[model samples]
Target: MKQYDKKMIVKKSNELIDAGFELSLNESRLILYCVAQILPKQPIKPDEMYFVDAKNFSELFHLDIAGVYKTLKNAMHKLGDRWATVIDKNGDPKEIRWIISRQYFENQGVLGIQFHPEMLPYVSALKKHFTQYDIKFISRMKSSYGIPIYELLTKRRDLKEQTFTIDVLKRKLKLEGRYSAWRDFKRYVIEPAMNDLNNEFGEFDATYKTVKEGRAIVAVTFHYKPRNKSIPLFDKQGNPSSEAPQKRWEEYGYRSAFEFREALELSETHEFDLTDAKEFLKARGKPANK
Candidate 1:
């Protein structure tokens, strides 16, 4: 096996930690070693990483297969649905294949079963711990394309920020009659989705400010880096190169502002249109518009 550099190992370890996997310093180092070995060719397939029965993981350390499964499970749960799953052949549960969730894999840029060659030696080291188990990393057949919640929220801030009270939000989203709709939206829709995006990219900074009596507004800020160089047309040898030019690179900031629910209600009340008194009155007692 080739010797691994301490800095590279540390960097890889940090990446795994950031991805929501928790391990001790020693365990992290070992995991990095494993990742380096398998990442060279590409992400390992379920079959390549585990037995057909899916009961035992290939020995990558002295840890037992069950213990490895528990660790993976905890990590996946922490990362949410985006990083958890077992691959099944033709959606058949019986044909089980242990695989990392698609979003997590793609975010790591593992487009196929192959990993960069530089990662192989670490994987080899990891395998030493699970010599009794049979596991391999395989390329995924389907493409991953789920957008993160944060991106969706950022793109549709107008709708989300609308003062639509619980009732209004439920009705507008066609979620009426569902109990705990607001909570559901916050937990399943807004938080998870946004968290996924933040994890993939970076988090948006959120802030709140008092806009009026009994009302507060919310805002989010995002930082984007612009390209900076001219596109490269060819390599030094005059061979065609696919590299694109770097446009002027700079940090661009964007801020999204939203009115408080109470403020929106108050604004609507004060600016009622006399042209339709009846309709305006009806809206007065009803939930605020989104």
Candidate 2:
């Protein structure tokens, strides 16, 4: 069986992060991992049915075959029973379930999931206002808070800075009563999550500061960007490496690699090797480029 070299997920952060739904750590990781495999390659079709082989789940999640089936079985049930809230015409929140229908072919190692038709607007095309990240970025992430924080940061990837009020942050993280004390939340949740994201999660490095209003901590502000190490100065061919080009494509919201290449072709300086151009652009960003 072929294994994925790299997996990617593209989702509108609002739906995944702001839906106010809860899932077990295992379920959350599994669902997002599965979604990465099933999402359309390009020109997303709203009515399309997405399928994932159980083997793919097992391999991706590093679980045994039987474990994959059992976990997915339970995960699907939870997903079916849960609801996501969306604002209705009256400006009130309305709840909708995610699973329109599902089928598990245990014998064939395949599972088919059809999302509710209503979710297409949030998950389809997603030409704008979407977050795209590679699964490798979170492969080592384990804490429940890790993925959500990662999503929150990635949503503002182009921004130089973003802040979340302490209360609002807890609300978004669904830890309303779990960590009543700011000290406990910071000691147990915030610190560890930040460490995991910076050290284990791929390329991006995030650092945050807590803001205080008088004696109380009011907000948390994060400064995030791709790691300087991940952006290689040059490849062996003396060409700009993939990292910078990929980052530019991501920042510009190019959905597909082909589109990014095509855009480069249409530029007036198309004849120049993009590698040199990329290096030149980087030089412009700094006082000096060694």
Candidate 3:
């Protein structure tokens, strides 16, 4: 019943973006609307919500399963260390549930009903982009029945934040090359290509940093920011920009050598048997016969 504030929604949306969750303009707007209505004192039961169903939520915006999944995933990742609930088919707690944080709830209030804080941003964005008729229908649902359809969803526990060590050269090429291969690869191949692409599409400044664990390269850091808003070079439309491959490659280049070594070690631990010899033989080709 309460009116939502635009500034509050924008503020929360920006916060989520800075935290590595990229949301669309429309999504940012809608999430703010929902967060504005959530009661701070009461934790809404996940099962008692209606808009949790991917199908139902998708209908609100005429989106497909993949779209719904992606939106929810991005939102969940943004909530980071938030609290939420998981329910089973019978609308009962599944023992495992999402536990959202008070800060997240306080920042992004709930809209139509109690929802996982992660869900709020996507749903809000959907509302923002849909047709007036669709918005009205959703708004009516919020005002009347509310979204009490959370049973079909499973809320997973937030894993403890573990620092991921990236091993770029070893992971990709499997070469026992020097750590400099990564830097050289990025400098010659990745950075140049990225710069060219950005120039063609629009320029985004690329920066890299290194992380080391003792003597090894642990991970490399690649940070990118658009040189300006006028150059819109995001390859994927609607999806979050952070998940793009170019961005990932750029980031991999910045990781430390120790990360690459750790990745190699991990790969060795999970070594799998290769039963298909045909492909292997084909790879060796005529040289093996000679």
1 against 2, candidate with superior TM-score: 2
lDDT of 3 by residue, 24-47 (tens): 322332343344333222244543
Once superposed on the true structure, which residue ranges of model 1 sit more than 4 Å away at CA? 1-47, 50-70, 73-180, 187-189, 192-290
Model 2 segments more than 4 A misplaced: 1-3, 13-16, 37-47, 63-66, 86-91, 228-290
RMSD of each: 21.3, 8.6, 24.0
Best by TM-score: 2
Residues 153-260, candidate 2: write the lDDT tens digits: 765555647898877777666567887778898987798778768864455777899899998888888887766322222222323234445355555555544444
Off by over 4 Å in 3: 1-209, 227-290
Report lDDT (Cα) of residue 187, candidate 1.
59
lDDT of 2: 0.61
Ranking by lDDT: 2, 3, 1
The local distance difference test score of model 1 is: 0.28
Compared with the true structure, all predictions reach lDDT values of: 0.28, 0.61, 0.31
